[model samples]
Target: MTRYLEGQTAIVTGGMRGIGLGIARRLHSAGAQIVIWDLAVDGWDSVANGFEPVMRQAVNVASLASVEAGFKEVVAQQGRVDILVNNAGINGPVTPCWEYPPAAWDQVIAIDLTGVFYCCRTVIPHMRERGYGRIVNVASMAGKDGVQYISGYSAAKAGVIAFTKAAAKELAQDGVLLNCIAPAMVETGLMAEMTPEHIAASKAKIPMGRFLQIEEIANMVTWIAGPECSFTTGFVFDLSGGRATY
Candidate 1:
């Protein structure tokens, strides 16, 4: 692997399994120190992947104080964070809008939208001070459209896109490049948890007729986190395998 990211540090939220972990491994192989932050909902830890000298982090994206404490600890130990990947999100509840449980809906929004907000709030300021930063947000293709049965997720991801755009503009002059990746029907464990019927429906919509591999998303993020994205901010990179028209 190239050392394009050598001497850099990355904080990957939800970085224990699936998409986030894939990103961590890829970046590490490319010579970036890894900070793995996951709530243990899926037993996600960097040690399992044989990451030497991993920065183990315990974070609760729903709470601002938890994010503050977690990132503060990471910086105290690692010194600085050069890249921040906000990949923690939820598919949210499945039900008609009127019939969805208020708690479930709020829960999804809390993690997907508010979580990204908190991470950006805590990490970007440091980036601004350094006069450099690369922040990649993992939004979904559903964020660009209204998919049936996951309204909360769609809305939250949509918020991520808009938020990325605004933040990018604000930090562009500060050398902070903020962007969001919108992927469709990725074959992460998240998809594995969906009902077979829902999975089939999602597959049928993909023009490529298959879900994306975890590495595919990681590859996209890797480039965005590197020098290649210096000129691109507030941009949306599509990884839908042709599922979305726009």
Candidate 2:
């Protein structure tokens, strides 16, 4: 039939690097036009050219106006967004509950959890109106398994999963599907921010004995965002390399 994403448009937050960038590349390969909203700006990355009219906007996900204005800009430039990938997120310091910084905790919640909320709240209406749209949210295995050192990040991602389920139920009747993916530890520069010991500990838990590749997660996102993703809403797809059971 029609090449799945032919003539379709997409918005990928944090699409400049890592898993988000990978998803942008995947969707582009499938024939979708893309607009990237992210804070990272490096001129050398080849993937930046993958998206047509790739607009580079540095945004703090916590700000409502930024979300609103950004989506508005996407629509203004691209006409309508057929797919929305909520992938911009963060992991605060790996500290015990008592040691967690209040400000840092807020930052994590804002970027990881509330960022998804802001995007969903604004973009879902367009999908609901179009009666044909797909939204893929990128959560983490920690959202399901709750790692020991990142209580705040875990709690925020847990909210993301719950929100995905609830929103899926509400939007399914409108022909809009929403799904969440939980990846364990994907190999990306993000890991560089973590301590060596922490990364080693995370790798030790995965039965696969190594970190996940960014492209692996991107494949899942593309599958879920495509036209055939019908009949599956509010479901969480696991990509933790067998680290999760639920």
TM-score of each: 0.95, 0.94
Q: Which ten residues in a row have the lowest lDDT in candidate 2?
A: 44-53
What is the TM-score of candidate 2? 0.94
Report lDDT per candidate.
0.87, 0.86
Candidate 1 backbone collisions, by pair: none
RMSD of each: 1.7, 1.9
Per-residue lDDT of model 1, residues 1-246, tens digit only: 788999899999898777988898989988899988888744544467756435767799889999999999988888889999999877866667888789988999899999999999999889999888899999998899877888888889999999999989999899899999999888777864477877888788888888888899989999999987779999999998888788
Whole-model lDDT for model 2 versus the true structure? 0.86
How far is 183's C-alpha from truth in model 2 (Å)? 0.0
How many backbone clashes can be found in candidate 2? 0
What are the per-model numbers of colliding residue pairs? 0, 0
RMSD of 1: 1.7
Q: Candidate 2 lDDT, tens digit per residue, 1-246?
A: 246798898888888778888898889888888778887555735534554435666665677888899888878887788999999988889888999999999999999999999989989888888888899999988898888888998999999999999999999799899999999998887776688888999999999998999889988999999988888999999997888876
Where in model 1 is the C-alpha error above 4 Å? 41-50
